[model samples]
Target: MSILNSSALRPSSLILIGIPGLESYHIWFAAPLSIIYIATVLGNVMLLLAITTVLKLQKPMYIFISQLAFSDLVLSTCAVPKMLDIFWYNSREIQLSACITQMFFIHLMLVFESSILTAMSFDRYVAVCNPLRYHSILTHALIAKLSALSLLRAIVVIVPLPLLTLRLSFCSRCIAHSFCTNMAMTKISCADITVNNVYAMFVSLFLGPVDIICIALSYSLIVRLVLRLPHKDARLKTFSTCSSHISVMSALYVPFFFGTLLTLFPNRIPVHVHILVANTYLIVPPLINPLIYGLTVKEVRQSMYLLLQNCKNRIRLWASSRVWR
Candidate 1:
């Protein structure tokens, strides 16, 4: 009976490793991670407020930035706090379903964020290369369609990962990562994971370079047009507009592709190294994206300043009311 039960037993929850080799140093790891998480939340929230509340920021580029902010917020919030939990409190037992849910949302946000960045590049392309038609080309309706398409594609592409995970029975379910990933989940299973690997490759291939390729083509075209322009000031301005998006693109894709490659062929790499690369791929972009857009993009910078100033005025008014009362 014991042998039979052991063969049929499926784990109800899985253990997440904070950092495998450095388990004793998890508290130290939490310090920087917590600080980054706080910054990401504050920065992205401020960006969202700046874009949504400011009338002048309702333009295509800012709108796309807001969408990107939302994705960053979701992605960071879904994974980072849980990681902090594992690091600070040793609270690493995640229910199987919850782990899968986290994995699903993390990948969903990644795909959606990539889609928004690609769309923003196109926004820049139209604005720089075909300045006259920018308004007609990027109507709010078009933005809505693009956003919907991005979301739908993310859902369709990522829904399979968790489902594939769910089908596999796990006797030993200690996952060697802070957050649940499809790769990490599959690694612990004794069952054949060929289907999962192939599907992962399919998802990766379909979702990965496609965004980079689109972004590259859009920028290349924009550069071509900018060079042909007669005015030096106009070229400089064009380059300025493209720079923010490029910074964001680099923030995401560089570490992302490197991490993905490591995840796919994770043989020689140390487990701790794999966890570090994965954590960096998710956390670094969120920390930097808001700062990149806020400082570099003039409209977002000015709008966020005004938004924060307005909040301060309201806070002062409230304080005065309390004092008078």
Candidate 2:
């Protein structure tokens, strides 16, 4: 869309084409996507409550799990409603400023999610590798620092996207994707985008690759230690302890890199495929993360079950206490 006249002024807003090549099916697509969004919200919120309300789940490990749930909640919530608006309501016009804000939060949550996963891996490593001092090392002060640092790192890294975006002038105020990303915005800019391109590469590498490396390193050490255990039962238990996290990490990073690759090879990959990958990357993690943790981790399942039973009993009590007469 950069085919506009060099003198054309930047428009105040951009029009998004919700899922290119599938405009005819936009409304049809809305049903399942809306259901997914609703389910994601409920799942993450349930997991978040389970972690926070359960006394046994107040440990540092579960603290990280809660952060993951919260991150997924914000991540999906940040983008899905707007996307549904575009699809269901045909509300395509997004103010340039608001679009930039959306871009900021979406990426912020993604980066923060990566940091939280890395923190989780570190927690597991410490728990398995240094069992006795797990509590002492992962103190409240340290957990608070790690949590603060996760948000601070996310902000410091992602905040520059909007600042950098301000310097560019758009050739066309039309975005062809479901949401605003650095690449989507840069694609339509009239200005020389070498700096933007370089910075985007830097941000992608910084946010994703660095976090992947840290997670990998942590898990490798944990696995190595687990391998040296004398008893097969202990080894099985340690692997079981790690399976849920590994599943979560795969759910996060695999599609992320796949989407990035699709974005990079835009000509080779179909546009709709790239968009689907991007949208699913944001949505699936929130939906499946709770399932992964809730089902795999016995304590979380028990907590959620208890919470449900308590709610059920309260309803019965409230119904019985009512003055029918």
Residue 148 of model 2, lDDT score: 96
Q: List, residue by residue over 10-104, the lDDT tens digit for candidate 2.
A: 77888888899998899998999999999888888888889899899999989999999998988888888989999999998889998999899
In order, the Cα lDDT scores of the candidates are 0.88, 0.89
Deviating ranges (above 4 Å) for candidate 2: 1-6, 317-325
Among these predictions, the greatest TM-score belongs to 1
The window of 10 residues in a row where model 2 has the poorest summed lDDT is: 1-10
For candidate 2, list the clashing residue pairs, or say none.
none
Please estimate how well model 1 matches the true structure, expressed as its whole-model Cα lDDT.
0.88
What TM-scores do the predictions have? 0.95, 0.94
Candidate 1, position 307, lDDT? 85
Residue 196 lDDT in model 1? 99
